[model samples]
Target: MRDMHESSADFSDSCIKEEVLKEKLLRPARDIRSILRWGYPKFSTIRFVADHFQLSLEERHILARVIMPPDRIISRINKKIDCSEIKDRKILIDGYNVLLTVDSLLKKELMWFCDDGYIRDTRYYFSKAKQAEDIEEALDAVLGFLSEASPKSVFFLFDAQISRSGELAGFTRRKLKEYKISGEAKTSKIADFELKTEGGNPESNVIVATSDGIIIDSVKEVLDIPACLMEKMGIEPIRLY
Candidate 1:
C-alpha cells in the first residue's frame, strides 16, 4: 500500500490534471453547441459529438450537459431568476428536477453550466429506495434555503409514475412543515406539463424551480435552487471519462 503522504501527493496531482481535462472539454463543448444550433436532434448529435471527440459514453454524457443549442434556448434559460430574488415570491418547484440536481451535486455527478450561465444536471432515473438519502438531502437543501428566502408559498410537484412518489410527496410536506416553509406537495401524471402551465401564467405569480431545459423554456421565471446550493458549497461537477 502507498504511504499516506505519498497518497496525498498523488491525489493532488491527479486532481489538478482532472481539472485541466474538464477545462479542455470546453473546446468540444463549443463544437457540439454549434452542431445543436443547426437543428440537429440531440440524440444524433450526441453520438456524433462523442465520436468526434473520441471519448467514452460517460465523457460524452458530461460534455453534452455543457454543450447546448444557441440563441433561442439560451435566451429562455437567461430568464431564470437569481437565487437572491426568490424572496417573497411563490415558487412552484419541478420537484424531481431540482431535487435530482442537488442529489447529483452531492454524488459529484456531472453538472453543466449551460451557455446562458444556469447550471443543470441529469440523473433522475433510479429506484426510490436507492434514492432515499439523496432525496432527503436535496429536499433539505432547497427547502432550507427557501425557508430563509421566506417565499410567500411553495408547491412541490412530483411525477406520479415513479414508485413511492406519493410517499415522497408526504415526506416533502412534513419537511416543509419542519423548515417552517409554506408548501403543498402533489404528484402529477405529467409534472412537466403541469409546471409549464402553472409557471407560465402571469396571474399565478409563481416562479418555477427547475433545471429542466424544456420546463425552463416554458416558464416565465425559474430558480435554479440546486445550482445555488452547489455553488455555495464550492461543489464542483464530477470529472470522469
Candidate 2:
C-alpha cells in the first residue's frame, strides 16, 4: 500500500503531466481552427496539423470533434437556447446522440465542450454494447432533466439501424410514463434527417435537444442536454482549446 505522502506525490505528478500535455496541444489546436476557418478541406488540414504536431490517433480524434471553423461555431452558438427556454416547448430529441453523450459522461469517459459550444464525446459510433442497466442510468438522467425542465411534450427519435433500437425506444416510452412526462419514443430509419426536418419546420416552434453538428446547423433552436447534465453534476468537461 502506498503512503499518503507517496500518493500525494503521484497525484501531483499526474496533474503536472496533464498540464504539460495541454500546453503541447495549445498551438496545434489553434492552428487547426485557423486553417479550418480559411476553408481548407477539414480532413486534410487536420491530417497536416496532426503530422506536423506528431499527434497520436487519439489527439487527432479530439481535433476532429472539438474544432470547427469560427463561422460555423458562431452559428451553432447562436442557435443555443437556455434551459428556461425549454419550458412549455415541444422538444425533438436526437435520442441516441443525447444518450451516448450522457452515457459517456456517466462513465467518466472523454467528453468536452468543443469550440462550437456543445458537448461531444470521442467514442466510436455504437462501438460499445450497452447493457440494460447502463441504458437505464443514462435515461434516468435524460428524463429526469426533462421532468425538471417541464417541456410541453417530448419526442425521442432513435436510429433504426442500430441493433435493438426499437426495443430501446420502447424502454424509453415506459420510462417517460414513469417520469410522468408527456412524450413518445420511436425509432427512425433516418433519425438525423427527421430531426433536421422537424426542427426546420417554421410552424412547429420546435426546440431540439442534441449535440449533433448537422442537426444543430439545420435546427433553429438547440439544447445541449448533456452539457446541462454536466453542470448539474458539477463536472467541467475537458477543454481541448
Candidate 3:
C-alpha cells in the first residue's frame, strides 16, 4: 500500500511538471512585442503574457516575471518603478508545522526510538545528524523562494516549547531577520490563543502558511485569509503557486 501511494504521488508530480513546461512553451509573441515597444523589459511582461494566454488562476498568481539584467541601452532607458505602488503583504507561518513537514523530524525520531539491538544508538545519532542537515537545507530553500517572491513582509511563528533552546531560537530569529522576515516565538502555552488574538484587520491581509488541518480551520474562521504550505520534497511554491 505504501509503495502504491508513493507511485501515485510520483505520477501526480510528473503531470504537474509537464503542465508547467507546456505553459512555458506557449509564450505569446505579442508579449515580446509589447516589451520591445515599451522599451522596458520588465518582468511584469510575464504577467501580461500569462493573462493574454488565459492561464489558470493558480498558474497566473504564482508566475514570477524574470527580468534579466538589461543591456546598456535598455537599462539606461527604463526607470525603476517606485516601491510605493507595490502591495505589501504579510505571511503568518505555523513554524513547528513547517519544520516537521520539511525535516520529517518527528518521523525520524520515531524510527530511531522504534529501532532495536546494538545498532540503535548509532542509527539514532545518524538520523539526528541527517535531520539537522535536512532542516538547514529546507530553511535555505524556503527563504530563497520567499525572497524571490517579493512579499512585503513575512512573519514566521514557531512554538516556543518545541524550540526552547536559546541557540535554536536565536538562530531562527537571526536567520529570518537576515532574510528580512519577522520571526516570533509563540509559547506553546498560548499558541492558539495568541494567534487568535493577533489574527485581525491588518493581519487579515496576511496569508497563513500551514497545512495543519486544525490551524487551517482556525485561520479561516478568524480571518478568512489565504494559505499555502512550504514545499519540502517537491517543486517549490514558485513553480506551483
Candidate 4:
C-alpha cells in the first residue's frame, strides 16, 4: 500500500513537470515589431495568429491587446460578458434588432434586363428567399449562444406585425429549458411601451439588449438599467463564445 501511494505521487509530479515543460517550449517568441504589425486593420492578423496557436484564455486576452491596443483591458473584457454578475439578471432582447443585423449581411441579388427586350424580377424572389434564410440563421445563432451562456432568464420581444408561429415558440422554449435557461416570448404592438409599463421600480434589476439608441436612452432614463447590443453580423460576443 505504501509503495503504491509513493509511485502514484511520483507519477503525478512527473506529469505536472511534463505539462509545464511543454507549455514553456510552446510559448511563442514575443517581438514588439510583430505585435505592432498585428495592429494593422485592427487585429485581424493577431486574431488569426491567436486562433492558429490555440492560445489559452489568458494568453488570448493578452494577445488581443497586442493586436488592438485599448486604454482599458478590463472594459474590453466586460463588454464581452453579458454582465460581470449576470447570474441574477434577466435579459430582455429585442428580436427585430437581432434580425435586422443578420439581414444586412445577406447580399441582395439584382435584376437586370438583357441587351434584348426582356424583363427580370430576380430581386423580388431573392429578397423573399434571403429573408427566410436570415431569420432561421439569426435565430439559431442567438438561441444557441444564449442557451450555452445560460443567463438567468431571457425574454425575446417581437412585433406582432411579424406573425410568429407556435412551432418556433415551442422550439425556443424547449431549447432554453434544455440548457437551464428560462425563455419567454412576447408579441406587442410596441415592445418598448410594454417594457416601460412592466418595469416596476427604478432599481429593479434588468438588462435590455437592443441596438436602438432611442429605446436604450428611454430605458436607461426610466428604470436606470444598463443596456447592451447584440454583436454585429458575423460577430459574436467574444468571451461568451
Candidate 5:
C-alpha cells in the first residue's frame, strides 16, 4: 500500500510567498481526477504530467492525496454518517486518529481536503501527536461534542503500541466523566481488529468516529469529528463541505 505514493520531484517548498498562485494550482489537480479514476498510480507519474505547471512539493502531495484515492475508497466514504445520525447512537472512536487530526487543525497545520470530502492531516501521526502541546485540549474538544451529541455511549480505543497510550486512555475516560457522557477508553494491541469486529455487529447502535481509511472501510458508518467541530466554529474548509 505504501507503494501507492512515491516522491515525484524535489519541487521547492517556496509557495508561502505566492499563496494566491498556489490556490490556482488546485484547478489542475481537479482535472487530474479523470486519469486517477483508472487506478492509484505513483505520484511520480502525476508529477510528470504536472511538471509543466511548476507546482510546489507540498501542492503536489495535496493533489495526489485528494485526487488519487481508489474508487472503492470513494464508495465507502459515501456511507460516512453525519452528526445528526449519531444523536441516539453510540460512537467508537479511533482515539489517536481523532485526536491527532483535531490537534493538527487547531494548530493551523497543513491538512488535506481529499476526494472523499474529509479533511486529513498528512503528518505521520504516531510520531507527531506526542510532540503537540494541545493534545489534552484536542481530546476535550472531541469529548465535549459527544456529550452534546447525546450518544448512548462512546468507546475510545487507542493502540497499545504507541507510547503513553495507557495514559491517553485514562485521560480520555476522565474527560468522558467530566463531560457526563457515558464512555470509557481502552488500550488495545489489535485496535483495528477490535474496532472492526465489535463495530461490525449489525445489532449494535455503534457508529465510528475516525479518519483512518482502512478502519473506516471495515465499519458500517463513520463520523467526521473535526469537520463537525469546524462547522460549529463557522470555519468552512475548501471543498470539504
Candidate 6:
C-alpha cells in the first residue's frame, strides 16, 4: 500500500503551480502510465520517465501520485459509491485525511481530480500545532454532510500521535452530538491500520470516507465526502485524468 503522506505535493500562492506543468507533461504522463500498466515498479518507472522528460521534483511527485495503472484505476472507481447510496449505512471516517483535504479545498489550495475518481490535495500542511479553530469551517462542512446523508452511524478516528488529536476527537464528538448524528470520535495510534482492518471485514456493512488509496482499495465501499464538498462549493480540481 502506498503511504498516505505520498499523496501530497507542494502548493504555493494559494494556487497549484503544476497546472501548466501538467499540460506540458501529458505525453510523459501517458508514457509513464503505459509502462505502469505493464506491472513495472512504480517508483523506478516514474523516476526513469521523469529524467527522460527532465521534469522537476514537484512534477515528479504529482505523477507518482496522480497516475495509477489501468486496473487499479478501474478497481477504485468500481469500489466508489454515490452519495445517494450512503443512506442508512455505517460510515468510518479517516478523521485527518478527510479534514485536511477539505481544509485544503476550503483554502483554495491546489488539489487533483485523479484518474481513480478521488480528489486529492497536493500539499501536506497540517501538524500537532494545528489549532482546532483552524479547521473549524472544514469540520463543519464534513459533519454537515453526514447530518444530511443520514448514515446509520459514523465513527471518526484520529491519529493519537498527532498533537492535540484527542482534543480534535473531543471537538468532533461535540459536533456529532450537536448535529444529532449517532456516532463517536476517538483517537488511535494506529488509526489507519484499524480503518484498513475494519474496512476489509466482509461482514461489516460499512463504507469508508477517505481518499487514502490503501484504505480505499481494501474497502468494498467508499464515500468521497471531499468530492461531494467540491460539487457543493462549485470548485473544480486540477484534472489529471
Instruction: Show model 5 residue runs off by greater than 4 Å.
Output: 1-24, 40-47, 50-56, 124-134
Clashing pairs in 3: none
Kindly report the root-mean-square deviation of model 4 from the true structure over all alpha carbons: 17.4
Prediction 1 global C-alpha lDDT: 0.75
Model 1 TM-score on a 0 to 1 scale: 0.83
Tens-place lDDT digits, model 5, residues 1-241? 1112333331123224235544666667755665667664747556865786777676666666555456656666786887766876888998888898888766655566666767786554347327223498888788777777898889999898888788778877777888999878999999999888777777775888887767777777878998888877665454422
Ranking by TM-score: 2, 6, 1, 5, 4, 3
lDDT of 2: 0.85
Report the C-alpha lDDT of model 6 over 1-241, residue by residue, as the tens digit.
Answer: 1123433453332234555666877888889888988899878998999999899887887887788777789999998989777889999999889998888877666678887998888775355356677898989999898888899999999989999988889998898889999999999999989998888898997899999999998888888999998876677777754
**Leading candidate by lDDT:** 2
User: Local distance difference test, per candidate?
Assistant: 0.75, 0.85, 0.42, 0.44, 0.71, 0.83
Winner by TM-score between candidate 5 and candidate 1: 1
State which candidate, 4 or 6, has the greater lDDT: 6
Candidate 4 displacement at residue 141 in angstroms: 1.6
Better of 1 and 4 by lDDT: 1
For residues 14-57, write the lDDT of model 4, one tens digit per residue: 55654553353233313322454445443565455566676665
Best by TM-score: 2
- Model 4 segments more than 4 A misplaced: 1-85, 103-134, 165-171, 197-201, 221-241
Error of 2 at 225 (Å): 0.2
As a TM-score, model 3 comes out at 0.42
lDDT of 2 by residue, 1-241 (tens): 1224546777577557657767777899889878987889888999999999999887888788888877788899999998767889999999888898888877666676799899998876455345445678899989999899999999999988877888888989889999999989998898898999999888989999999898999989999999998888877777876
The TM-score of predicted model 4 comes to: 0.43
**In model 5, what lDDT does residue 171 have?**
78
